[model samples]
Target: MKQKVAVLGAGSWGTALAKTLVENGHDVMIWGNHEKQIDEINEHHTNTHYLPDVKLPEALKGTLDLAACIADADAVLFVVPTKATREVAAKFAAVCQNKPVVIHASKGLEKDTHKRISVVLAEEIPADKRQDIVVLSGPSHAEEVAVRDVTTITAASENLASAEYVQSLFSNEYFRIYTNQDVIGVETGAALKNIIALGAGALHGLGFGDNAKAAIMTRGLAEISRLGVAMGADPLTFIGLSGVGDLIVTCTSVHSRNWRAGDLLGKGHKLDGILENMGMIVEGVSTTRAAYELAQEMGIEMPITQAIYDVLYNDVDVDDAIRAIMLRDYKSEQEFTFN
Candidate 1:
């Protein structure tokens, strides 16, 4: 089926996804705020700033007019940063006339409320104008996906049919999509893994070996599962693509902005300077704070997240944070108790 798709956000992830949709034989339009980037996508079939030197499909278009981009579209995909999601969703809701299968690829919890992205979208997109919300997430990266590298991801929704529809809509030879009904687990894992990735990158920057990275990643999965289960997520979902799978790629891959940001932090760079230099959203930075607060409120024992949060928000030195984690009271590996 040839459906019109509106992709919100012209950043690296959004552009890569738009390229995927275009190759999948859909009528795809990317909605962005920057006029220059939009013009580049339209006139040159390129988004050099985000996906440098990667030529977009000639059929793919970019637009500043959100109304025009989404008008009569069969689906709306939100790939913007977590902070911008609500604002963009509100704008889209203002002009969306017909029901579209609302989907989001962005990963992160709301800063203060700690709500999942799907919850945020459901709140903003009118029930009358939207179908079930679907979340597309996994271990894939924008740079790799932009070049047509083989990638697999998950499409999760409470509505199984909606998840399957998204799975078919985006799947291709190189990009495979799996369906999962655990929206809570999928979204929680997707958002929280970035925080762990930051810790992994910091370990690298601190000159730690693979042992440290493995410990952080292993314990990080436990933390993610703990919080996720507390929020009514299926515990089994943590082992799937969106959980441990996403953790492996983001923590180790150089393409991860959060990892890079944490590496800089470990190397004595301030958060402001690192963020300014990267010129991309490091979701882990904000996620650390949000997760820290959420964990505290829920009484979840997430020592690694707490350590990263201290370093990121409390001005604790990275060395001190690492030391704190190392010196924490020893516990059995099977200490995880799902509420």
Candidate 2:
């Protein structure tokens, strides 16, 4: 069935997803706060700043009015940044009268609350205006996904039907969607991988070879699984798409903002300077702090996340922080192995 979908946020991911939805024969109305970007999408069918060199689907429309976008929409896809999710959801709830399936593609924890994106949406959107929230995450990058690369992602929700619904909506020859019921595992893996990407990028910037990068990726997955399992997620979920799949892609790909940010930091650039230069939201920079604090509260040992946290926020030298990690007490790497 042809559905009217509202894609909130005009960033690269949002534009790319909106275009994909259009290609799937859905009427996609993308809503953004910036009138200029909305006009660009409508008039030029291009979002040059975010998805440069990619032509948007001409049938896709853009809107500045939130109400118009939400009116009679069958589904609302929240593609805004992590920081703006709560605020945007609250606004979405205020204007939306219908109970559409709520799905978020963002991958990060809320700064102060340290809550996952699903939790934030559940709290912000009233039950009357929303359905069970769904999370869409995996190894897909907007730049690659925009061009229809063979990208695979997972649609996870507490309800299997909801997840399957999303899987059916997004699956195409180039873009495949797998359904998983482990929301906690999927969200945790998706959010925490950015921190490791920072570490991976740092390793790259510090003149480390593939051996060092491999070490970070391996140990990083361990820490991510440790913290994820501690937070009530299934340990095996880390091996799936949102877990190892996302970690490998984000930590190694040039399309990763988190890796790029970490690369700049590893090259001795300040956080503020890197953010300014990147002109994009580097989720790992903020995720490091959240994961660091959450680990402390949960009594989970995440040394890698802590090391990146200190480098990003504590003003510690990257080399010194790395040395501190390397010098930590060593034990069996298979301590958490499935026996």
Among the numbered candidates, top lDDT falls to: 1
Error of 1 at 230 (Å): 0.3
Query: Candidate 1: RMSD over Cα atoms?
Result: 0.9
| Candidate 2 segments whose C-alpha is farther than 4 A from its true place | 336-339
Predicted candidate 2 versus true structure: per-residue lDDT over 213-306, tens digit per residue: 9989989999988888888898989999999999999999899999998898899999899999898898888888999999999888888899
lDDT of all predictions:
0.93, 0.91
Q: Which pairs, if any, clash in model 1?
A: none
Per-residue CA lDDT of candidate 1, range 143-252, in tens? 99999999999999989999999999999999999999999999999999999999999988888989999999998999999999999999999999999999999999
In candidate 1, which residue ranges exceed 4 Å CA deviation? 337-339
Candidate 1, overall lDDT? 0.93
Per-model TM-score versus the true fold: 0.99, 0.98
